[model samples]
Target: MKVYNTNQIKNFTLLGNTGSGKTTLAEAMLFEGKVIERRGEVENKNTVSDYSDIERENGSSVYATVLYAEINDKKLNFIDPSGSDDFINGVAAALSVTDIGVLVINAQNGIEVGTEIHSRYLEKAKKGAVIVVNQLDHEKASFDKVIEDATERLGKNVTIIQYPLNEGTSFDSFIDVLLMKKYCYAGGKLEISEVPADQKDRAEELRAELIEKAAENDEGLMEIFFDKGSLTEDEMRRGITVGLIQRGIIPVVCVSAKKNYGVGRMMEFFTRVFPSPNDVPPPVDTVSGNPVKCDAASPASAFIFKSAIEQHLGEVNYFKVMSGEITEGMDVVNNKTGNKDRISQLFAVAGKNRTKVPKLTAGDIGQTVKLKSARTGQTLAAPGNNVVFAKIDFPEPKFRTAIKAVNESDEEKLNEALQRLYMEDPTICVEYSKELKQTIISGQGEYHLNIVKWHLDNIFKIAAEYITPKIPYRETITRIAQADYRHKKQSGGAGQFGEVHMVIEPYAEGMPDPAMYKINGKEFKISVRDKEEYDMPWGGKLVYYNSIVGGSIDARFMPAILKGIMEKMEEGPLTGSYARDIRVTVYDGKMHPVDSNEISFRLAGRNAFREAFKNAGPKIMEPIYNVEVWVPADRMGDVMSDLQTRRAVVQGMSSEKGFEKITARVPLAEMNRYSTALSSITGGRAMYSMKFAEYAQVPGDIQTKLIEVFAAEEKDE
Candidate 1:
């Protein structure tokens, strides 16, 4: 593969809501570029991007697809990503590496969930973006509404570059504002013609707006536009490029991918004006804490943004070269882990296949095979450079389920496949619960994990089953009490006996100090809490003073007692939840020289802790999260009302660009499928994100209900 200069490379990600024609547009681009001999439709399961079995079955992209197109002397790297929130993991990862974001909007639907969802990420990425209003040939298509939606939702930066001469079913051509000419699709090829005299007035009006916006970016162009009140085609083209590179303006183009109309023009626009890697900001500090800047002339340094497990290729690490050239057979250091590995083969990916390349230069995206130590978000540089790229912040998994292999024979295979999938998808998380002894796989939503299971069964041939995840509810004490127990045992050897008495009480608002626990002759007192400080129990140990003043209980049995109490704390006495921050003092006790050894005392301590727990009041605690839902202003009232019904506490509301950003705290237990619920309420037009804020006390009734349910489930399992 040949390396392209920064200006010769056009890297962009195709993004938008499902059914927005992103894949279709991508196919048209490929077809027009002649990269593919023929265009494949999504409905036929032959599109280049959504080529996976699941994607074909669903007729939507399930992962990010990489394809290349060399058009007009420019090499374009097209990242076609899935738009569903379930598969947004791929979209987010794609945004991390791309230079431009092309948000496809259905001319009929105007703006949908994906339009709002991906726009936020693009804004955060600080990448230049263009709104592609596609499917103009469809019946009842509303290009005007889409344009209005684009301007309303995307902000004033949006500028029109083309206007449909005829819209909807009549849509056949577009007037190129930059060229002041009409380009019509004739015989599946773009043909330039003079602007229609009747439409020339409209064309000039649109062209004037375009030129004014373009001129706003350059002083010379602004003076020319002001003096002559018009801009030449060449001047407009140069001005658009400057505006795009500076992210000062976002150009819009109308296309009917179904008719393959305007695609060639879109390609021309990208090759001529789209910003390149050198025009975008460089990668900053990665999680490993090293900053890397793009330097085509410097030693090799690249960052892997995505990884895939190919049956024949093993591990393919897709990366973007930020500095100098990286060649096959050259050793590179993983700045993250300080491990060095040789790139045995480097290739440029085209769909599922790869074109082997001798070297990949800076600003170019490529892949290396069989690099075991390399993974997404890791930086690779010439040995010892220690440069790292910026880390991609992955969204938290919104869904979870317990999974188990179909048989013991496939357990290891299942584990291996899941691990590989986890490495490939940062949003997918898998782990085993020791207490439940079951593996739980989690992702953005139910559909997300379903795809994982599908891959595990079909791709890796490991059958598995899933169950609803355990709520992770916890138990705590609400009141104080005391209990005592004695352990006496006699085996075939010497007899053993030990006794313990401890009191259970409420912990302070924070953590319990030494004063919280009191040693007494007839009563024992200790307090446990549910606050952050109490969460740190100093390894579940509390020092007991030798206040006996006369050695009431021998010091030899204290360690055994402390050990037993710690063990009991781990296995909750009430409902098997870990106990927290309570002090146990051995103020008074009895001892037998021969029988009161560590083992006897340990048992005594465990029994005593259980007794105290039974006497004290117990409660349940649920996890709470801070949720920020961004919705249209018109839907704010409905969203807030719905949140109230879910027992959410609305913190406040703020305006964000064009949406209402509402912040609230809600229990995680009540928000398991809030994404789906929010969609239902907003008709799939709202977007939300949540993070674990803090844990709060569950309501008394709900707490009791959860405890009962948990107890029943534990018994059934």
Candidate 2:
């Protein structure tokens, strides 16, 4: 393998819609560069980019594939990530380390929802981009219409550098406006020919437009274009390269990746026009809070963007050399985990295939095996540098499911497998909900969760079941109520006897103000009344006041009584949900000195609190979430109507770009599988994101049904 410097390295990520042929384009590039002997198809499950079992089975790319090729002594590293929204984190991770983004658009479909989503990401990252109109050989392909659509959506910075001369069935040749020549494919070989007379006028017009756009990058070039009427080939190339690096021009190229039509020409353009690593600005160091340049002589620092767990290989961490050089046996420290790790081996990766390399220079992408502590989005730098890179920002998981081991004994194994899987894909989150008493797994969507389940079953051999997670509803009182309870037991050893009388009421925002109060007909000066308000860790308030007077109950036994009340609160009297925002005042109680142990008072308090709760105006509160749905303008009415059916409160509605943005607050119970529902309603053209807002009272009918369901389940148990 040949080592390349930062200037010779061209790092770019292929991004597009799910069926835009991104993997096919990668395969074509590899074959053209002679990195592979032949191109592989996604349907055949042989493409280098979609090699994972899940991807092959799903007939789509699920993970990002690292591939590299050398052309004209320059190394071009391509990060081909899954185009589906379910796996969009891979694209984000790849973009964090790449210099350019090549958006592959299906000519037949033109611009779709995925294209808009990816374009927004590219804009947010502020990275240069090239639009590749792929699938030109498709029967319904239209180069002109697609170009118009691309320009409208991606802004006027888009310029056409190449176009198919005869699209659709007869798409075998294309005219390169920059080179003023034609490239025709014949017998598996490319032949250079003169531009056809019929297309010459259009090609020249496009060329003049390209020249004008390129000249805008430099003042001198603009003056020369005005005076000389045209720029020399060398001058034009330099200006275009400058425009591309600054994103002043986003050149469009045409290719039929499956047939290898015009792919080689695309590769040539990447090597000549795309910006190198050195051309891109440096990223900020999270620890030092300074920009770190891509300098090999500086302190060595690298960032792990992706990680994969192979059966035999254990863990393979894919990283980009951010600064300095990474070599074998180099001792480094993980900034995020604060664990020291030694790079035992460095290999340049092409899909799952890797070749051992002595060292990887700055801006180069490579992988190493068996790191003890490093994980994705972690920075590994030299010991003295103490510089940590910013972590890659992945979208929050939007869908959740409760996972249970098929066999009770496999619970430990199931947990371990989930941990390992989460390490491999940070977007997949695993959480243990103590309130719900279930292991919850969250991911981008249904497809994402399905992949996780598949891995748990097949890779770890741990059978598991996924079900809709239980909502963490809360119980709270709305009115004041009083009750008394006496617990007495005669066990022959020492009889237990205790009595408790308590007043319960709904806890308001500012209750229990410091003041004097009377309890048990005694004038007790309650100076620290405000201190009785205890903020519950799980949210809301739990106010407890000791109002017993005349030593009716010992001070030491008050904690026990509070503990008993807390236990009752944990498992509420109605529906067994956790209770919140309630005040319990133990005004009076009786105790037998011999039988008045902590246990006796505890049972007395517990029973008293349960009695008061049943008398109080108890209500069930379900978790509500703020949901924002983005859909096509024409489907706004349909989405709004659907939301109303789910008892959602529409907060606002607005238009953004070409989509309608709808904001609403909906109960979590009503949002189960809502992502799937939205996709179905909009024909997979809508997207939504949600976050917890606040707990709201469930509807009367719904609350009744929930209580009935819980009681039935308890009876069954």
Give me the candidate number with maximum TM-score.
2
Model 2 misplaced stretches (Cα beyond 4 Å): 217-247, 484-491, 495-502, 508-533, 545-555, 584-597
Candidate 1 structure lDDT: 0.78
Error of 1 at 429 (Å): 0.6
Which tens-of-lDDT digit does each residue in 625-697 have in candidate 1? 8988988889999999999988999999999767899999988877866877898889877888888776566
TM-score of candidate 2 versus the correct structure, residues matched by position = 0.92
Shift in Å, residue 352, candidate 1: 2.5
Q: Please give the distance, in angstroms, between residue 212's alpha carbon in candidate 2 and its true position after superposition.
A: 3.6
Lowest summed lDDT across 10 adjacent residues in model 2 is found at: 522-531
Give per-model TM-scores.
0.90, 0.92
Compare the candidates by lDDT and give the number of the best one.
Answer: 2
Please give the CA lDDT of all the candidate structures: 0.78, 0.88
lDDT of 2 by residue, 1-717 (tens): 877898899999999998999999999988887789988999899988888888898898999899988788888999999887888889899999998889999999988788878888888898888999999999999998888888877778899999898899778889999998999986668999888899899999999999998899988999999999998767777787788777888999999999999998999988988878877779999877899999878889999999889767988899999999999999999988889999999998889767899999999999999899788999999998888888898987888889999899999999999999998889999999998999988888998888998898778899999977999999998877777889999878888988887778888885644245443464434333213667777788898888777778788888888988999999987788889999877777898878888898899999999988988889999999999998998888899999999999999988875778999999988888888888899998888888999988898889899889999989999
Deviation in Å, model 2, residue 521 alpha carbon: 17
The clash count of every prediction, one per candidate, is: 1, 0
